[model samples]
Target: MKALVELANKAREVSGVRIYKRNVEAVLSAVLKSGDFWEIVDMSSLPVPAASGIVKVLIDEGILFIDDEENIKLTQKGFDFVRELGIETFEDHSCKACEGRGIPFYANIELYREFLQLTKDRPKAIRDYDQGSVTPETTISRVLFMDSRGDLRNKDIIVLGAEDDLTGLAIALTRKAKSVLVIDIDKRLIDFDNQIFKELGIDNARAMVWDLRNPLPEDILGNFDVFVSDPPETLPAFRAFIGRGIATLREEGGVGYFGLTLRDSSVFRWRDFQISLTSEFGVAITDIVQNFNHYITWDYHSETKAAELAPVKREPKTIWYKSAWYRIEALPGFKRWNEPISDDVFYLDEEGSTT
Candidate 1:
């Protein structure tokens, strides 16, 4: 009885795999459908206490045996026992966000070191901002604003992801835009923006709480003359936005001032991911800039340092650290062709690896 319970527990972990009473009618129904068999596990990986309990229970019940190869497999009687209980197995779950790619979160995780270094002595820089964080993309936006081409006396503009310097863009653009629409995920931050705009007499800007992860509403798409965002650097999040942003732009060929960071070591791998976006979506790369001296900072705790240190000058790193900025234009047939002469591409393809 103890062994029976233990076996049932394992099946429950896998989807479509469960232990239930076998009614003759249901058993017949199951027979017509696909079924999963047993799963193998490394005994060494399991906790000693749990493994001992399971092994003892199975051995006492005479349903498990170790073969000549020293691997455990269920016996005929064990299979029969499980079948009587209507036990089933199933395939592992795949992440819909990553499309079964295991490293869906790696891009953000790789930025962890940069975040640490940025906030090492300057905690306030991140905290002063609404999202309490400063990303490489935000820094890039600041850099672009310093080098923007056109006048903004009455331009129509939209700013997405008002977490860091993007918020500043919204506020700055509102001063000149005929109408400024700001979309952000945090309602509190949106409210804060509204209050600040009112206090500053920057009433041209309107704020709405929005999530970039969700599908952009039809009413909002293709409505802005200029769409701006410091989109998430993570690939899935980035992919989702590029397509949405391209659809949101006006056909007169509006500018999209977007920024993102590639890991110091994962530049080639990142370019590969970026190429996937351009191929999948019709976004063209305008200018790719590298900020080797400035690091992307975060604000999980303090903000003063984040705000102060952000503008202050910094020394460049010797190696192993970089903040890259990309200026992308939303246009049809945008292609970023990797140079065949690049040794990085050659090494990646030949070595069959990713950082």
Candidate 2:
């Protein structure tokens, strides 16, 4: 029965439902504890937007019941299943937002820690200091974000302009993805990534110096299952990076992950960017996780400016910047943006002003 529950959880994780398996399991355990076999459990307690769908999945699998009031109840099969798994009492041990995992709402703690250990000595954030790099926590969180979306195993992932190598290292260490390729303009970043890959004996991962200002390399065009980027928040820069990412993806069902922030970009900017992605690029915005990329202050920024800012005056002592993560999926036969990168794509003048 424990194996059966594990199997069910695995299936749910790989399913297109986009909700964590632990969330569904937690809901079930809660229902069993309520002792209301005839009463429907209120769906609001679950964290996922598709909570009703999860309940329906349980019902479809003969593990739950839905009364006329739309409340949830455990079936006899469900009770037996939980009992066999040794869930004698329902205790919510998971995190409230991420369920129990430390990363997203329900991260696998072991996996998260492994990611941190692997990327602990990642290349320092110096060359691209204006677009500050994320902390180890944020990097692992990105991996968790992808895991939550069922986008990791056997997937070919490309990171446009990988600065700190956190995401690339995390994916490679998983050893599940078919391939991990990072393209960046900075030779330093690329070299650092390759050295890490070599040191870790990660054969499936590689980094190359390919500027997004140019077209994606012909050998890898339209060959990836996922593309990840933390583009410059400006309109032109964002479009350029996202355009290159889309161009590298498989024609259909390809996933793109990127980060945007409210500090620099306004609602109107978000709307335009989203519309361009969906309408012109042929991808639908599926999910947006708020404050997903928390960044640490690095040495490049002027200390005078930091002191004048607010709250924290010292460098590396505070984490005041963050970006919201965006997950978009490609529709069948989606058109990829193939425009030439504009000259202003590397603009960082706004970086200091915004920070």
Candidate 3:
């Protein structure tokens, strides 16, 4: 999972201390094996106990944590510290700056550290880019809950997808909500969520793996104040969630946000989808934010592993993200199907045409 690798790389980057090779190996091995806790044991298999003792030193220094069960847990502070190491240039662990083997390897420690802090303490899932598609709706849902604003605090928010959508939000909203109800289709994801909740001591959030297509149980009706989500973009499930989300809202104060990652083929389709929402649910476009698609070129690429590494060559990649924000408000006037042209989306003509 790209997100997991990113998280692990983040942990190492921020640690501030130059980890001995054995300790580094142990910590990474533990992080990959233990999903939530960095707990790695089997002291008998590791290099001498003196090397293991280094982990304790790291723990004492707050770089790592050993829990009651001897599981290693990285503190937010520790996690953040390691992640502070900037984007590193991979060169087979050879000192890039000094070309020496004995010294702490010089790499992009600071950048890595910041990225880790950005992702830490949030519910995040990683996947290969090709494995799943992210819709604008999904991205919007993520931004609504995770963005710097405190809009959802103390509000009852219901999420449509549990695994990727609300994992981070649940952790965040616990500080702000009276409660969060998450519904999903994956039982295993729910189990992972519970573990995270337990680790963070977040008590106001509960998750259940349930498909969004089926009719919700009676107990779930009219229970949420804000219904926000990025449902599976192509499925009827997305529409179903929208209908049910509005039904669950308390009244005129209810709010909903959707994420839809528009693909090359779906851009026109998305416009049609928007119109459908307006006609069917009286939802209006409230906010739209566009992100300049940017790529992160690191010091190392995948092919460089083991076969004599080199200083990473950086390249730029660009991707575009457009987010539309809407609210459930009564239509005030005649519905004009014409989209208001924004500079970010298109170039408009004096004749009122968009390019």
Candidate closest to the true structure, highest TM-score: 2
RMSD of 3: 20.9
Q: Which window of ten consecutive residues has the lowest lDDT sum in model 3?
A: 346-355
Per-residue lDDT for 227-263 in model 2, tens only? Answer: 9998866666776789878888886889999888654
Question: In candidate 3, which residue ranges exceed 4 Å CA deviation?
Answer: 1-150, 166-174, 292-355
Worst 10 residues of 1 by lDDT: 35-44
Q: lDDT of all the models against the reference?
A: 0.43, 0.65, 0.42
Q: Over all chains combined, what TM-score does candidate 3 have?
A: 0.45
> Whose TM-score is higher: candidate 1's or candidate 3's?
1
Candidate 2 to truth, TM: 0.65
Superior by lDDT: candidate 1 or candidate 3: 1
Please, what are the lDDT tens digits per residue for candidate 3 over residues 1-355? 1233433344344432222344444444454344222113221122112223444445556666656654555677656655663312112333344222121212323423432443355333332111122332233234333323344667776776534533334334336666777776666556666665676677887778776556677677666666665543443434565666666665554666654433111344456667766776666655443221111222232332211111112211221222233344324331212222222212111111101
Find the candidate with the highest lDDT and give its number.
Answer: 2
